[model samples]
Target: MDLDVAQVRAFVRTAEELHFGRAAGTLAISQQALSKRIARLEALLGTPLLLRGGTGVRLTEAGRRFLGPARRTVAAADAAVAAVSGADRPLHVDTWGHLYAPMRTLARVAGRAGELVSGHGRDLPSVAKALLNGDVDAAFGRVHPPLPAGLAHRLIRLEPVDAVLSADHPLAAEPALRPDRLSGGVLWAPGPLDRLDFLHRFAVRFGVRHTATSVNLGLGHFLAEVAREPDRFSLMPADVPLPRVPGLRSVPLTDPTPLYAWSLLWRSGDEHPGLKGLVTACAEEGGRSRWLEYDPARDWLPEPPASGPEPV
Candidate 1:
């Protein structure tokens, strides 16, 4: 027999309310429409489900038997919806290359095994929202306070930022970059949701001029745009390499600060066994991750271990 979901819903609601008029009101349909729906459901099932009696409605033996399967069908449908809604969009990792080093590595490993769909974002809120809404498989995000429930994360990189410039820019020839000299330029700011806004805040925190006009979430796009420009630049860690855009140079910042700490963010405790391996890969990559490195002795750190020092 052909089964329609709407018919199933109507049937369930009628069973719930027991009063046809109240059920109709609950479903926002006319009592007559509700009655017709019940008629259709009964006709399809080839059974008399309801008996009009004294002051209330009663379900026939067939109705009682069908209730279990009907509820199960609705539950199955809901589960299907949740899965589809969660899987329809590509999983968004809400951090730049520097922040999501471990997640990227794990994703690559998983990809080889044909087990994951991976992508990235450039900011925290976007990652958080996507994870909360089930749009991403995983992301690298900051350890923000009051984190939403059901997400698991581990530190992957703890690095200081440096100034990045075009080869032709004046600072490109400097011995080392400093925050004081990092301001007053068009910057490549990446945000998961609002790239420009996040950059402005970042600029303010570092006392750099936050007057950037162009920002983007896509690193590839940022590199392309910057390569074509003359005075545009932003502060990045020396270890976080950029795409080999011709004429682009990233220099070490002299008075570097702990500006970026990267982590892998995802729905925690998934039953998938592959996720455990992915999590292990991320935790092991911490501080020593290939994506960025840290030399603490020389005060040059990117994905460097917090305890060790490396000479510049």
Candidate 2:
């Protein structure tokens, strides 16, 4: 049988708060509206759920019984909806960042029932807006100040930023590299990697001073450029495997570089079955498993960088 999720949700919130006024505030509606919703909900159930007295309000026998189990039902319904939503998509997203490999890996784990694709697109701000605007299904990237609005997020993975240096560098040959070892090398960085302002804001935290030059180039291009420079190097999503750019190679640098977390994001009101399915497929991947297609012959590991950084 179909259930009024709105009614159920209202009931659970009010019951937990134990006060209609407080619950109304929590639900971001007025007390009168909340009372009416509860009344409608009780009418549908054919029973009285709450009783108001001088001491405020209390659940009735039916409501006491319903309160305990109804919360579970609401949560279950939310889970079911989340499942249906993530698994209901044939389309995909490719925000420029490090979440690509793992995102694709999730699709593989979801099996043939779901089809996933990855492509480069607009900056995080715009892509996040696009997802909220129903342009794309989801985007993966970091936002320092938190997402603006009309968006829902689930963090998929954390990618450490590594000080990448040319293979010929003295530290590049080191097995265990640290930040201090990276001192004095010419640095390459995205103008804004995960909105941390590239390595500028994070350098002090990392205890390493870097000379920023190619901050405007995207991650892919920066890596390629760093690969070309004989003595130049940069920082990138460490987990993502970098492909060989002919004369270049990348190795980890030591320091307290910020580890950027990328999350799966979508518009709050987007309920398209295709998009939802795709989202669920991604959410299920997490770090426990990966769901992407990797090409090895290209000098890159299974799932290195997905998209480039935004142009400064």
Candidate 3:
């Protein structure tokens, strides 16, 4: 029997929620209807997909194995529909809010009709999902390793990350702070979850014992937290200016300063002539723009220690 999209969608939603009632609510159907859909899916597959229990439901081995492909199948179908329906629409470009200067420059060079969608204070996973699902035509953000297999990417610029500290702190008097000085300090702005391995490697390389903590706050509040706490510090791109607080200062992290490389990513095999023009514009404008001023002394930092955190 052929697989049915509706049944597959119901199964996927049920698998995600792990609750028939909630999944049905999400799908705007009654629990009974949701159960029937999942039953039909199981019948078509000729195997038990989910195990029903008192604590709700759990995906059986077969269900676990099929989850990835099911999601991809749905995404592919959605992307095809979007491509045909939006053929005449302008390109949608996503990037960090602070990086708009360079992205705007790219748009001008491309000379194509498009809009910039800023990912302000958003993490990499969400951005990647948007690209994969065709929510956006192109995007710019920090380099995420093991980029999705079907996407193409190019390095745009290398922006150095600087240390933010309370101006009155003892180390604040130094012209440049050493990486080792960060030991036992708390990082107010936690790095992305996808970079857990990288963060571990960084800590080992610098011989620093730092704890990263996340705070959900706007720029004003974030700066206030840094200014109020003597030991609390943050790492931010030197190219982007932070809210100026009376007791806060942005200083270069020395003895080894880390650089965050920004990249432009798009779906591979996408043959939109306009996209090609956009890519050309990005390279051309990126070449002439001084989005980042690289200091030779800080151009390259020491790599993480050979023996570091294991991949997650």
What would you estimate as the lDDT of candidate 1? Answer: 0.58
Question: How far off is residue 245 in model 2, in Å?
Answer: 3.2
Better of 1 and 3 by lDDT: 3
How many residue pairs clash in each candidate at the backbone level? 12, 28, 0
For model 1, how does the per-residue alpha-carbon lDDT over 74-105 read when each residue is reduced to its tens digit? 54564466565644333334454543243434
Give me the runs in candidate 1 sitting further than 4 Å from their true place: 1-104, 107-114, 120-123, 133-137, 142-146, 184-198, 215-221, 227-230, 237-241, 257-259, 287-312
RMSD of each: 13.0, 12.3, 6.0
Cα misplacement distance, residue 289 of candidate 2 (Å): 3.2
**Local error of candidate 1 at 217, Å?**
8.3
Error of 3 at 169 (Å): 1.8
Per-residue CA lDDT of candidate 3, range 107-177, in tens? 44555434344443254555665665555667776545656544677665666667778886667777787
Instruction: Write down the worst ten-residue block by lDDT for model 3.
Output: 303-312
- lDDT over C-alpha atoms for residue 276 of model 3: 59
Clashing pairs in 3: none
